[model samples]
Target: MSTTVLHARTLPGDAEQRWPARLWGVLAVLCLVVFLDGLDGSMISIALPSVGHDLGMGTASLQWIVNGYYLGYGGLLLLGGRAADMLGRRRVFLIALGVFAAASLLSSVAASGSLLIATRFVKGVAAAFTAPASLSLLTTTFPEGAQRNGALSVFSLFGALGYSLGLVLGGVLDGFGWRYVFLMPVPLALLALVVGWKLISRDRRPRPGRRDHADRGRRRVR
Candidate 1:
């Protein structure tokens, strides 16, 4: 007599699945980063008049404060993605996030309009790196299919919410001081950095077998 045996094959993303709590943590951390990006972008609009008044900046000079940030963000966005691919995603994200926080702190205490605009540009450059890295981390962390779709929906929601809240918060915080708008994100970013360090998975190094295979393929092509 002969016996037949059957083994089930796992789906593509099955092996990458994490516990629900950990998945939420990853999503939250990424969401927070996106939130900060949106917040910083919109928050200053409400505070701009106050900033101009305080710094005695003209309209033309005040415009640069906003324009400088967008210039840095739009210019380097593609480079940020390439960086994440070459370096580890988490490493790039965390480092950029730190830079964003530091820039935010400096912006709050800037002695001149030029210094403030410079810091805002730095913040935007940092954000360019962080925005892509956060998305890369999110896609890699969550497997494709329903899980990834749901996580993405939530991730996008935080961005819109952050912008909305920033508008309101900008008005409220500006009442206290224009500086508060810049200062608010510093603590939140630091918190995300600390928590992300623990929750986000480390990047996988290339296997020796795969490296050798790739090398052999390249040699054949050449």
Candidate 2:
């Protein structure tokens, strides 16, 4: 698959920034990761009424579909945030991306309303982990104020676009079937998964600049 190519090209990271070209590619990939979270929320809203009709659900039952995602996402975000801190951000991010993608796949094919709701909860919980871990990666990567700000601007832009596009996407996809709304995220998720595994640095933290410190100390001594 195309993912195999992505992995082969992305590994053996240039921590020295030897290839600025590759660095940009890596940045774009990470930005794409956070975009998915926003898109999912907006996209599902557009499809919900149709989903309710197709699945034969009442108002109370339909509410649970959205509520379930929020419950899992909101309830466990604190725990997920702590885990991202204690565990490696890269580790949590990759695992969460995998879980989200798997849950989405399962959700798209679910035979019943109950199964769909359960999978949505799983997706939401995974999002909590991925979001914080991704932001951590971004901040760590571009530690300087200017660079970090630029990266954040790009990241936020993607998130905003994802939300705006989701409504249009949901309406289009819903015309075919509500299931396509679940399916919509698959390609984006898979690409992020591949790039996350390959492009995201395993060594995400920066080392202290002992050389600069030494220089300052020498000047002081003189």
Candidate 3:
């Protein structure tokens, strides 16, 4: 009898994939931004009564505050994702997050109902960009495998937790002032922005020639 041995073959793309050394830090930053986006979406709902009373906004005008956010969020969501693909994901995420933070600060000091609603709309647009960019960044950062799946689960958990926690936090912050509800996210956003800039890797744009070649190859394949 002769002894036989077989060698295992490495799958395609297996060699090209690499996980970042600071993956946990990157994931945490992504999660924090996602949580803040979710929190901002719902946090003001509970503070509406206080807002209306303080700002002298009627029920109809107050509704615009909430509607403004949803309008911008839903309207630009698809465009935001496309923007991330064309522009750099890291760049889009950082810019959007910065806008989100600034909008939060402005909302806190908004003198009129119209100004506050506009700030909320801008925040929603920023969230639309950040959400997709962060998700795409997560996928690229963690190679496809169990680790990526686990990271995704954690990321999703934070998003849901934010919305649920927002209602509770809104009530608590409302006790101080309606403005406090808006102010709460400002610090969190700023912290995430700073951390994200440090932790997230820079996007590598393909050289013009390489990109043209890639497009040609894809066209041939199609």
Whole-model lDDT values for every prediction: 0.91, 0.83, 0.91
What is candidate 3's lDDT per residue for 1-222, written digit by digit as tens?
Answer: 123222223443454444456898899999999999888888899999988988999999999999999888889999899999999999999999999999999999998999999999999999999999999999999978877998999999999999999999999999999999999998988898998899899999867798899999999999
Q: Any runs in candidate 1 off by more than 4 Å, and if so which?
A: 1-19, 208-222
Error of 3 at 175 (Å): 0.5
Clashing pairs for predicted structure model 1, backbone only: none
Q: Of the candidates numbered 2 and 3, which has the greater TM-score value? A: 3
Question: What TM-score would each prediction reach against the true structure?
Answer: 0.87, 0.81, 0.86
Candidate 3 positional error at 4, Å: 27
Q: Per-residue alpha-carbon lDDT of model 1 for 18-118, expressed as tens digits?
A: 44888898889999999999999998989899999999999999989888889899999999999998998999999999999999999999989999999
lDDT of 2: 0.83
Candidate 1 vs 2: which has more TM-score: 1
Q: Could you give me the TM-score of model 2 versus the true structure?
A: 0.81
User: How many clashes in each candidate?
Assistant: 0, 0, 0
lDDT of 2 by residue, 67-127 (tens): 8888887888888878887888888988999999999998899877899899999999998
Top-scoring candidate (TM-score): 1
Clashing pairs in 2: none
